[model samples]
Target: MQMYNPEVLGVSLRHIQNRQERRVCEVMTAELADDEDFCGCTLCIEDVYACAMSRLRAHYLHRVSIVLKRPPPNDLEIREEVCAAIEVVRLRPNHASVT
Candidate 1:
């Protein structure tokens, strides 16, 4: 009897997310890093990402047969999502004030 190993096959399920979504989140996080009121710790940053992503419509790219995927458009919606994410982090920060 041989044991089946999925890792050896080099195949796994993954969430195909919009690259722009990450880009926007990263940019926002960096922009807010200097704000004294904003906590830029790892957990809070992750919270921001989660909150923002939840509010925006996600674009997924998967499947090997799929052709080239277009870049996500930068629009007002992206700005709104980043703003909302910032607000969420501000209101519910997981770290203590450095001051």
Candidate 2:
């Protein structure tokens, strides 16, 4: 989870936060702006959000490559599946929501 670029994950998490409820990705894929760091520009906010959506799509389908360098093992995969897209939901203070 910590493996992907921070800009990608941070923006995605923020987008999920704006949604109606907690979500877990069935697939997750990361996308970048054709122009580097275009995500930082307010004018391209929608583009940034779309990039995040791309990542979310990748996870829901169980192809979580955005934040992982290699495929995860069974236990980790199960964990990701169970906990995917949890950004929209707040967890207990001790729960570290974004594991």
> For residue 97, what is the lDDT in candidate 1?
59
- How many Å off is the CA of 21 in candidate 1? 3.1
Structural RMSD, model 2 = 16.3
The residue-level lDDT of candidate 2 at 24 comes to 21
- Candidate 2 at residue 30, lDDT? 24
lDDT of predicted model 2: 0.32
**Residue runs of model 2 more than 4 Å from their true location after superposition:** 1-39, 58-99
Q: Write the per-residue lDDT of candidate 1 for residues 2-75, one digit (tens) a residue.
A: 85443436765445546567667666766686777777788887888878777776666665536656545466
Candidate 1 residue pairs in clash (backbone atoms < 3 Å):
none
Tens-digit lDDT track for model 2 on 1-99?
A: 355332464454332332211232222222222324222333233333344344432322223324545342343443354333222221212233333
Point out where model 1 deviates above 4 Å: 1-16, 62-74, 95-99
Residue 34's lDDT within candidate 1 is 75
